[model samples]
Target: MKGVAESRDRSRSVLRIGGVSGGVFDRFRSIQDLAKDPSIHAVLFGDWISEISMTFRGNERASRTPDAEQVAFEMSFISALKPAIQDIAKNKQRVAVNAGSCDPEAMAKVVQQLVKDHGTDLKVSWVTGDDVTTQFKEMLKSGEKFPSLPSDTPIDQWGVEPVCAQAYLGGVGIAEALRHGADIVICGRVADAAPVVGAAMWFHNWGREDFTELAHALMAGHLLECSSYVTGGYYTGFKKELLQSRNCTNLGFPIGEIESNGEFVITKEKTAGGIVNVSTVTAQLLYEIQGPLYYNSDVTARLDGIHVADEGPDRVRVTGVVGLPPPPTTKIGITARGGWQAEVHFFLTGLDIAEKVELVKRQTLESMGEYQKEFTTLTFNVTGSVAENPKNQASATVDLRIFAQSKNPDIMSAGSHKGVAPDTPSFAKWVIENCLQGYPGGTPAMDLRQSTGKPFFEYWVALFPQNKINHEMHTFNGMTIPVPAPTVTAMYPRQQVSYDTSSPLPLDSWGPTVRAPLGHIVHGRSGDKSSDCNLGLFVRHADEWDWLRSLLSVGKLRELLEEEDTGKKIDRFEIPSLNAVHFLLRDHLDRGANSSSSYDILGKNVCEYIRYKKVDIPKVFYDRGTI
Candidate 1:
């Protein structure tokens, strides 16, 4: 084996990698930009995976051969990327991606074919064995158990049989593919940041013991993994006046220049839209992370003391990331047939809105009667305000959404229910029949498909020991290299830390106060991790940090999310360096993304919603407009 000091190449040490897509539809313009940048060593595309991949038909057969339609859906990015791929080949650069959801080998063949048709000699290879749908069943039969995350419940209690399963593979296989001269490496079900880590490790010749370098690259990958997120795409806190100037609509994807010293500068295409600064990087750092330890299959990133510094315009330097050995296990996403779901909305508007809602609900319940009993889950969500005012009908109208899900598909079907008599109408028909009897202005949405039962999948995330996985690298020239197990061990904290009881100066001491949305003085970013939701709240001014930390305690968070809290566990952590407070709302998402019933399934909008909650802002800080 070549040592880190002797094997690395430094001419391309800048490690310029641009993120093309977060999923299938994320910004595609970056690919062309990547092709134009000769210095860029590689291009990493996150692409669509898991529940998102399920949108394509035949995803359940990911372990098997994909049909032409499935292959077309999976390789849709390649069509737009052909010209870019040719440019990359001309520049002698490489591409690493996890866009090959279930059939990476097949995707690689298509890519190779594209290269051949273009008359370029670029080689393509794909990593395999991430698909564990068959192995999972074998393991379960042999007495292996895969417990659910956070809850630690037995897999059987998940209430659905897994249709397809995949383990989060490491980046080593990708590196091996690169080492064997593969110009493009396609992967399936690897962690989102694997491509960056793989490319950085391969370029720098970093060994397993180079934990610090790996950690830096991991954070770099994390910052760049979401494409435009680190480049002002979600930085709405930048005041309307300032944000509008950046023309965020045509946001550019990020490029990280990672170095061997374990430090990197995050910058995007200069000609593209959006801004990059300490604020954007910091917000992205605090996005969707779990506590202090950010674990990946390759290595664990200790983010307790991470720092983001403003180097210059459109550039941010991230440093101080600590690294630990890789965890013993990897997270496996087991997708199961959750059941079927059906939803329809009734518009309730104007005077007597409350009465109209109640009338609609009462009649809907009565209409379903015994049929409702067959539903495994049912919900009534009333959205929008009926504030007293002489406003337009649109302002006064509220959407009363009725949603139901059940393992018994017939229960949620448009025209059938196992429990109901054959002659009786289905729930949809019943609801329509009662529309005439409902409130005077009640009207259901015109889309009839919403009332029909459609299959939904439950995403059960569990930890599977890395050693049990059959991970390997498939070289461009038909050779396979088995990936070794991680050298490090990891164990989560046995107990969570209780909230800090320290008190701060009273709100009155900060001078005059005004009741307004907390967003005016604070910024927040929220995202989902499995069934849990991570919410990071930050303040622009150092002086305001203390106020934010003390004011938004667990108790305060509970009060703010009281209606939606549902008595779930909440863990809060304070990061003084970033002037931020992070909270993990356990079991907040009804289930994982695929099975979630909420409109904001991924919880991406939770931060904005929390920002809308009214809170007292000190007039002094409020005046600075830096909040």
Candidate 2:
């Protein structure tokens, strides 16, 4: 608690945001420990419903009546952090969050009740107007089309009903609310970095044109937006080394000490677990980024020129952030009712793993009979490996997974049509019917219920003009403010940059080499943007920069990907400052997290998967089995 107060300098401000929702807090320590510092100006929360959450909700078609259960689920942090709410009042610090997914007004009321229950009078406000389902529906009626950014596929081709849609709002509304004396601000779907941008602008009284400062604040927010991401939470690449430095079980969340000029040093609370350095900061900076140009509602932040340098123990100074005017349009997340999907996993152990998988697939289809035609899409994949002289049965086993989806619920629910078939229709039953008769050594990992068909949603992301949104800020007392439009207008391009085919190098120049995993010579991160996935690979040694740059070009990547490369567009960029190569795989994950059938919809494992790809590493970079 004492360290929290001293954690921030008076000139700058911000704390690691807990997460996208209060639900994330449940998995961590008590909220009181998070807000124990009095000197911290404000605590921000990003609770805006994510695209994945909306797909899971599936109740968008229901009446607009406020579902108490849903509200509690979204804003559960209010009750979860009741003590912290009291602490914010005691410290007279401000708090801003987009905890209200679709209903900011109701969320604001909940905050009011919580403040009253805590016996502390605090001013609160809510920002709204992100919802545009009505506007979208009207546009659709008038023949306006919304296309998926990754594939350019029109919404009509998705073959799903649009349920609910929300536009990504900016930090302007949050900043205006603070200017009107609101102690706590609640919002719907602002950008993930909006809270930090708003707080920094409020503290410095910065105008919209303060692009440079705003961009710096944007980076700070992006770094802390995922809470513990910058604090070794996702730094599991070198588990033994990272785990030794910090007990990741209770890893301290990141905190940004933004100086007056917008440059900030990312660090953790005193005596807290987790390490903060150039690598950790770099990992978070590259997380989920599309490219050098990062677009936000507030400003167009450029990241290609950014710099990260170690400054003392567990501290990294991040500077050189440049910004442009805000984009002319804001991105909108649209969710539609997709078909039903069902999947089952079978464990094939030891000998004849490949033969056993083929037998299982054959029997499964035979059992389905005519019912197999009901599915629109069906796929089978084998995971894990059977190695020579394996250590244990678990390691020797391979998991064969089957997935299927269909627009007709009945078709997906249909069971075995085989002789003396079970009474009701079910895909789970069909898969289980083969369990006893096929694949001599095949066994399902668990119960069949998990593989039952369930409804899924199609996610479509597009850009809509900012002027179209009817945004507003509701004050604590009884006033409303219309958010001003962006001073500088711009539009987001389809792609940030073209593929880098300029750098081509002979494959054999580096001398005696060993075929090994790329991870030993390079460390990097990967994440998803809609259906596209980006992998940013970097080498720590300066000497390896040229080799890495020349070696990881788009052509080299295609060679590495082998048959997995579907001939889709792959763009690569060079980040010389970090000696990193960034790649964006277009339309790689089906239709993104909501509808993608891949296990790794977010592409978090792309880097690890790529790292393990067979590569001829120069002998000099591969010393004693590691770089």
Show model 2 residue runs off by greater than 4 Å: 1-30, 61-73, 414-422, 501-511, 624-627
Per-residue lDDT of candidate 1, residues 1-627 (tens digit): 235343335665677888777777775666777778776656555655545464232244643453434452356568557768778888878888887777788788888888899889999998988877778888878877688775677887776777777888878888788877888888888888888888888887888767888889888888898888888777855566246575657777888988887799999877777888877888898887878788888888888688888888888998899988887888888877667888888988887877887887788888888888777778878888776784688888888888888777665666555565555446567667788788987688989788878877777778888887888888888888898878666776633454643676676778898888888878889988888899999898798877897788888888888588879788888777888888988878888577777888888888998988999888898888645
Model 2, range 554-577, lDDT digits (tens) per residue?
Answer: 888888878668688887777788
Name the weakest run of 10 consecutive residues (lDDT summed) in model 1: 55-64
lDDT of 1: 0.78
TM-score of every model versus the real structure: 0.94, 0.91
- Candidate 1 Cα misplacement greater than 4 A, ranges: 1-9, 54-59, 62-73, 241-243, 415-424, 494-498, 501-509
lDDT of each: 0.78, 0.76
